[model samples]
Target: MTFHTHHHEQVAEELYDIFESSFDEIFVTDAHGTVIMVNSACEQYYGLSKSDFVGKHVRELEEQGIFYPSASLQVIESKQALEIVQKTDKSRYLHVRARPIFYKNGKLKSVISYSRDLTDLMELSHQVDKMEQQIEFYKRELVQTQSDITGIIVHSDKMKKVFQFIERVSVVDTTILILGETGVGKSRIARLMHDRSSRKTKPYYEVNCAALPETLIEAELFGYEGGAFTGGLKQGKKGLIEKANCGTLFLDEVGELSLSAQSKLLHVLQEKKVRPIGGTKEIKLDIRIVAATNQPLEEMVKKGTFRRDLYYRLNVIPLYIPPLRERREEIIPLVHHFLTVFNERYNRNVEFSPKVFEAFLKGEWPGNIREIENMVERLVVTSERIVTIRDVPFLQQETYTSAHLSLHQKLEELECRLIQEAYEEFGSSYKVAEELGISQSSAIRKIQKYTRGIE
Candidate 1:
């Protein structure tokens, strides 16, 4: 071989070695944007061999979605250097920069596109975003917890876990379903989540679905345009959803919504837009939804009363508040909280007697926090400085003798009364057992069984 020809062939070999050994993906396309060569890294990135890409037109590969917005094609068209981000069909992100090579005559020779895999970086960015959201949520929660008026009382471990979960999810703009009995403070939980969320400054409206009449529920939720109905306002009326834009909408007693209303609500949730009962144009919304229900929604779904799709949408995050009888540790703290609240509200310094506290500890608060608040207010308003056990209306009515009971019934009543008194006197199951001469497990079992029936 001639000396100059051998020297040029050696240079080409070195260049080819460098191109094939690169960790990044490298594609060399002709002036017409046809793939002439691709590095082996393409196989790792797109799960396709180099042969699959080579000899294919850039436009054809882009149409096939191998990697969208082919950088080589853009460089070919513009005849200049281009940098762009592309997503492959395998869902991998690629950061690409393509530069067109030119001949001495200023004619395009080839395009060399270099791509670095950014899928891991993109995933890490998403994780960082989630962590930042959690940090923001905790900052709000810290302020809320340190404030004097913390609205709700939490003493039981069960409640503590629930609050922790709320703190984590409050920042996420997902639907939350608060599940509990009538007065276990489901609405309070919902409000707490909204207060800790990003939309706290915006309007937070609570709509009691059960309180709204079935006939007007639709119109109330999705407002009516002018002349849409016989009794409609002359100007178009904004619904609760529209009013709660960029905020939160708490749907209390959500299970009471009719099936038709449920379907419309589902559509709004899915589409993020709502059309009024008589409106032709749809109103867009940016709102978070928190729903509460005492009813068993899953059972309602099985019965075909509740829409299954709607139930799934609302139940994305379910927070269940246990009954007062189950978490009796909260009872005394709640009573103290209510006492302080009512005393300040009524301008009365009424104190509960030891026996009154005992009665409260032993009683089953089927009506939950609402009942406690009412009872404290009643005592603060009506009682003397010291509210005695006899002052409690429920306890006063429970004064009964076992004279009309059978032997089994009498023993059962005596067992229940003794357990209640012991539990009231000694708070913990172990302490109650120490006082009542029973096993600790038995004390716990008896407390669970009898506390609900004590009053």
Candidate 2:
């Protein structure tokens, strides 16, 4: 009996030495799911000391997402050995194996679990998947013609259909009305239509009807004779429609046109000719009209704000563009695209962290493509080697609030802050315009408005 007791102690000491020396985590729990003992390796694997894990219930730890699937619990239930991969709360991967110990009467006794960290291997596999996706992206890019939407990225099925629509209508000289929410790439789609058309070699002009003041919209669209207005040019200049003769005229925000201006535009679309404001002779035109607007023109037509005849003329080939949030699949590709573009433009090599990508995928993107472009450019220009969620505080909150204000007032305040900072950083309206995706003229106007008292 004395010899047998000494042998059992020696065997227990050897097992304890093995448990302490083992590189992989060794966790033991009783049949009741209570942790009995854990090795020092738990500290490195889970950022917890042996004391933190010992005496704790395995069920509690599993619920806390320490390491999911609770292998010890599974072994206890099955009364057999089990092996499987598990995920920790920190997104780490582990290859775990658990074995059950049985009593002399075949009742459950204890369960021992061994886990090896597989986080590095899992990360490497994810990288390979990303590389494969990149390869597929490059292949799709190669399939597209450079002249077709030069800088646009179309990966979603909805956008692919939009591209197909552009191709079919490009050969025809029909008027197309592009309807979409703001910043949904209506302008770029118009450009793609012009590029794919027979009018590719001719002049292409984009006129932002909303940006042009109501007082000047008519004169700008239909030209003015010399001395037609107080500050007119000495020599009468051809209006955008006349300038775009034999080509395409993209009237952006066409819903903003005044009633009288809409009348004149309808005449031009019907007669294919324009007469200067103070001139007697009329000039013929052979232009393709492509109009885009975020406003509900049909509703405006019912309200008599927009002309009915003009709406019918412009809506001949109506093309609706889905907003970015509706096409979530395209978000990542666009992020990669904008990152590449801004990196090249700014001579910096910056990348978004995985968390940033996740956030982008889950974002609402109220401003659509323009918002993403601006955000990616801002990150590329301002971030270090990697851009994380910390770089975008606006994502955490809907709007900046310093006082009680209406939504419009809040937006104006935000715009004022952005314009001010952009002006300070770039020191030029053109750069600020480019940074904010607005026109240089608009940028100048805003800079004057927002930076009125700044030194």
Candidate 3:
């Protein structure tokens, strides 16, 4: 019996040593809520000595305000475990867990509690939340910057759908072909695609195929060797394709490419390499192609004027922009956008009258966004504070006033004007019929009727 008592005392001493060395604050209280034991960590966390709490009732500690609403007392009363966040008088945060200890007779024996400091973790969580908010703010700013850089002003459902498509395709590296009528902002859309893409920081090259002569376009696109032809630069020049390496190349009026040029372009697209004229070496390229045309490439393909294979390669991702007449809802917003732009450019604050808006909304925008921008710039530079109907150009005034006519009369007048213009330009009923996509008999009858009225 004496040896067993000594061994038990040695075991108790070892447990006390372990309890003192624990990193977490640990305390034990009797069933009556009197403090019985506490670890050394409590002194550093709560600024209290073990002697200050040992043998003292929890209520006494609460009255002295050493800690508020004692967790051990609650666990004793409820006979269950409880978790809480407690703050000390020294401005330290603690995550505390208290559990009731039971005896062999199924009766409560004591309460044990554990607490860990939570100050650093809580501070880190707050910092992360602030960083997330800042990231969201910068994302919104980037979106606005992209819109401004791309010159995209959209409101109508038709154009909204187009914008959505642009966003969806910006991440891809596939070739994109933009189909739209002349002056319908196809070039702007191409730029928008480039701006939204991951290659935005790289160089962007634009070439108007129709603007360059057929004899010069091949050399312009494929570049040339030193002294390859008359008037050529000594060092040779880098073609737009080479200039757009690892970036985007916008080919405007791609349908205007001659057959030989189209064949060369197709080879480049297939092999991702460009060979300069009169040069033996071919330079490899990593470029995204964005092509635009006012003409129908599919019809050109059917007529054997455009290579079917090249058309397929360019048409991998086709986006069609509707004309201004189909999206009237966008006119006012576009006008306002241009108004703000020109107002700043010319340093004027001109405004349009209600009647002017009425006239603008009613007229057919044949030249699309380009014409609107030109008109707004004209008004900003020429008109006074408030632009009235009379401030519009004489030719446009006639166009605007004609919108007041009945729908039937408007259609008839437009048809007559078109027929007369086609006859004058082509000078033959067969040519007029072909130009207007109508039968020869219909063209002859319409031309005669409109001409007779003119006489």
Candidate 4:
């Protein structure tokens, strides 16, 4: 009996020593929820000495506001282990786990509580949340920038091909010529090319050849020295070409340039140098040229109205954008896009009726994408929440005519118009089929039907 008592005492001393050396705040409480023991770590973390808590009821410490809602008291009441978050008077956060010790008879004997400091972990969590919010904000800003910078919307195969070609040619430094009718987004394509090119970070200069008079076109393109021409700036302003150094210069409506202007532009292209009018020295240029024209340059070259050398120089890379009627698939998507834009601008939520959509799809959009966008904006501002067919006055006559015609006849008319326009643009059944989103045989049959009487 004496030897057994000595061994038990030795084991108890070892356990106490282990408890004293622990890093976490540890407290042992008796069955009545009175704190019987506390480790030295409790004093360092809770700002209290062991004597401050020893032999005190758990409820007493909580009432004194040393710490709130004692974990050891919770374990005594629930008679089970629990983990909880607690706050100390010193404004520190602690994660505490309390385990209830039970006798063999299932009666609670005592409770041992362990607490770890949680201030660093909570601060780290807040930092991560802030970073995630910042990332989301940047993402939204990037999307808005892309939308504002490049409003080009491509959904049809025809426009998709144009974008693919732009992507391929953007990396290379060469002159590009865009051919299309007015308002077919030719200038937009020019801007897109510049945005995608290596000189994207530099200035993008645009000159509308047709917008300026013949007399001013030369001075606008090639800077004139002070006193070179009447009413010119005394300081001799830099021209578009010089302003666009190390960047891109877009010449819109290039076919409108006079013979003298054309010759000067050609010289610039050949020598990569421009001489200011009445200036003795030539300014060397490091610029890329992108020209757009609605006129047929080839026919003009044959007519001797446009210079052949300049034509070849500008036509190095030819990109033609078909009219909206030819690529009908893009009409509805473009309509929705413009609708969204206008709705936001006017702070309205207007919606289109089913019949309105049908009229827009079937009507001849002569001005192409620009016309559709304008009409949508007009309707968004002028019409109510629901835009019906009656809102579009221009389509009323066409709709009445279609109402009288048989279904087959109406479809034939639409098909004939599509085939004729596609053939004119593509010049081949295979290409027409690809552009119109139809089979080659169908395109050929329609083309032959539509062109039978003409040729």
Candidate 5:
């Protein structure tokens, strides 16, 4: 053969090799959308042999499960390049793109497609959606937490004293016990301490001792290693103590911790170390423990339900929070605060009626500040226009009718009510000390002193 003919043949063969070995799935089709060419990945994706696909119509092969051909239709219809996604029953998701190929006279000739599978990307999208939902859920929780305390009006001197106590003790790491009637913002005060303290920037882990069963509580406070038991994460988990390292741990309803749990917790407080469940290694923590309860812990120790030694350890800094009733002066400000917050959340312009304020000042609020917050949220969620006395829930309307008495007698009565109520609410004098706003050990001594006075 002539050298010229041989040279031409060699160039053509190299071009063919490049087309065949390319990573892209390149197909040339006539105006009618026929498969003129394909590459290796295309062959694997559609389970097709070269000869079988060579002369086949692109759409027909897609129908016969040979290759995806929808991109060709898009290219034809739009007269432009566009991206499309495809899914197969047994395979993952895919992203397909199509572009029209034009002839020299500005007439349409055929379509070319470029594509990639997107199954993993779709999975990543799903994970992103779940994360967004979780963020929204936590945002709602934070709003509710803020609202719960906003309901307790705090104009009273006693509550101001509690606030002052919190301010004074915030910089110290002394274990603080919060004493108050149920719903009187003991947990909020605990948070205030953490927020104000040197540990404000660290994780603030909260535990509700009564919310979970004893078996789960240990694992929650100190994470367990995988195989610690059936269904435990394969790799052991970090305990809350570890999470609270260089942070603060808030123990709510601490009076409810079982004797076993209390002993373990006391060890943590004394030595600043925690040993996780099913794990031998002990983790050291730089944490501040804020224990709160509506209970009478000293009484519990007297009854032998709680340990006295643990109480003494936790009562290093005693801060008391008075009930909403004693702090009647705080009612208006708290109500306004909640009203403004809920108004924005519920999308309304709401204002309290004068009578509602009157009812608030007079009510006993056995459920304390929490009840007021819940009521405010309810009104915002369900009511329309400016809220009035009539719009307030049934229980709130009845608060003004419960009592009439002398000022000093009333103060004494409220104080006694708080003491008895706290004792019943928490069942231990130590808890009473904390929630009623005193040291656990002091709560013990106060109960002893008071009971003797009544006798």
Candidate 6:
């Protein structure tokens, strides 16, 4: 327990040298798994210095809930080795493997665990999940915007949370249901959830249940064996469920599935087994089910347009992605992200004039990220530089002020609207003015003049 012993010091020095070189934490724990020696790397990893971790229990510093104490304890008492996730106050997921040491008499002495922080991986998984949701959202928005599908953008906190939700669920093996409006990105979230899960490295197969012919739905999902059904492949075809083995299967518009398909899909999900069309034996496949729908499934189930049992099965982790209108705060970022994307695609640098962004905030992005992406793409293809609000035909033609107001008093109402919006958006006069393409002093004067009556 002293600072050093000559023999242990020599060995500890070598270990410290190794620890200093390592990016991960490496510390020595005593027989009780309490910190006996701390390395600089270990300290830095835990946001502490050597002096602080000298006496703390290693397990206490990690998330005990993530581990099975009995299994971890066995590694120390029986000289076993085990790997697990370590959750701590500072970090959520750390890849740790504990290796135990034994005496000549076969008695266990102490255990050493190498722990690597993987919070970034979890975050990355989350990002992939987010993008997945965004992409799907963009797809629906693409159709809704009546804008170009090649161009899509998402900039909304609501959409970002959708992404975060997808990321959180990527690693989990469970059935996920994505719900939103017609133009919302449910399918994209499904792909995202798949790409970030344990199955990310595997294939992602997608099919739209609504689009498939009702008669062929079963064959497409479960595949048919040669001679099993008339006109079936001679060699037999692998179903979408089978094709998604060890990966993710995205069933879009699940609400549209026929009762037969729903029954089959539900069985596949529950049993983790698939049957080929006309095949006698059921085949097992490793699959993650990601289902999506724009329909109000619960309402439909109540009305008997959709199945109640299938609804419950797919709703294990229900993700309700809010529409673009809710997260207007993300409009600018989404615009920029889309602008950059289109700029690269078309080799054009399209700049947004002050009015364009103002117009963006004013306009409703019901199509969500997809609509923005299309508009940005249009700018890329049609215009070159200084893409102004006028360049957007929608902005030029659309009515900005409330439609209920008469034209005569609308200007005064519009001025009030702009000032109020700027104040709320910027939280300060200077920021609003910058966004509004005005001087801070002018912005202050305007606010002073306009609010004088109310104040």
For this target, which candidate reaches the highest TM-score against the unseen true structure?
2
**Whole-model lDDT for model 5 versus the true structure?**
0.68
Q: List model 5 lDDT by residue over 144-183, tens digit each.
A: 4553334333446787777777788899888888877888
In model 1, what are the clashing residue pairs, if there are any? none
Least well predicted 10-residue stretch by lDDT in candidate 3: 142-151
lDDT of 4 at 155: 54
Question: After TM-score superposition, what is the CA distance of residue 427 in candidate 3 from its true location, in Å?
Answer: 50
Model 3: per-residue lDDT, tens digit, 296-332?
A: 8999999999999999999999999999889876665
Stretches off by above 4 angstroms in model 5 are 1-154, 393-455
Model 6 misses residue 271 by how many Å?
A: 2.2
Question: Whole-model Cα lDDT per candidate?
Answer: 0.79, 0.79, 0.78, 0.78, 0.68, 0.66
Q: For every model in order, what is the number of clashing pairs?
A: 0, 0, 0, 0, 28, 15
lDDT of 6 by residue, 372-393 (tens): 7777777888884766444678
Count of backbone collisions in candidate 6? 15
- Model 3 misplaced regions, further than 4 Å: 1-150, 394-455
lDDT of 4: 0.78
Residue 274 error, candidate 3, Å: 0.5
Scanning candidate 2 in windows of ten residues, the lowest lDDT window is 142-151
Worst 10 residues of 4 by lDDT: 142-151
Clashes counted in candidate 4 amount to: 0
Better of 4 and 6 by TM-score: 4
Better of 3 and 6 by TM-score: 3
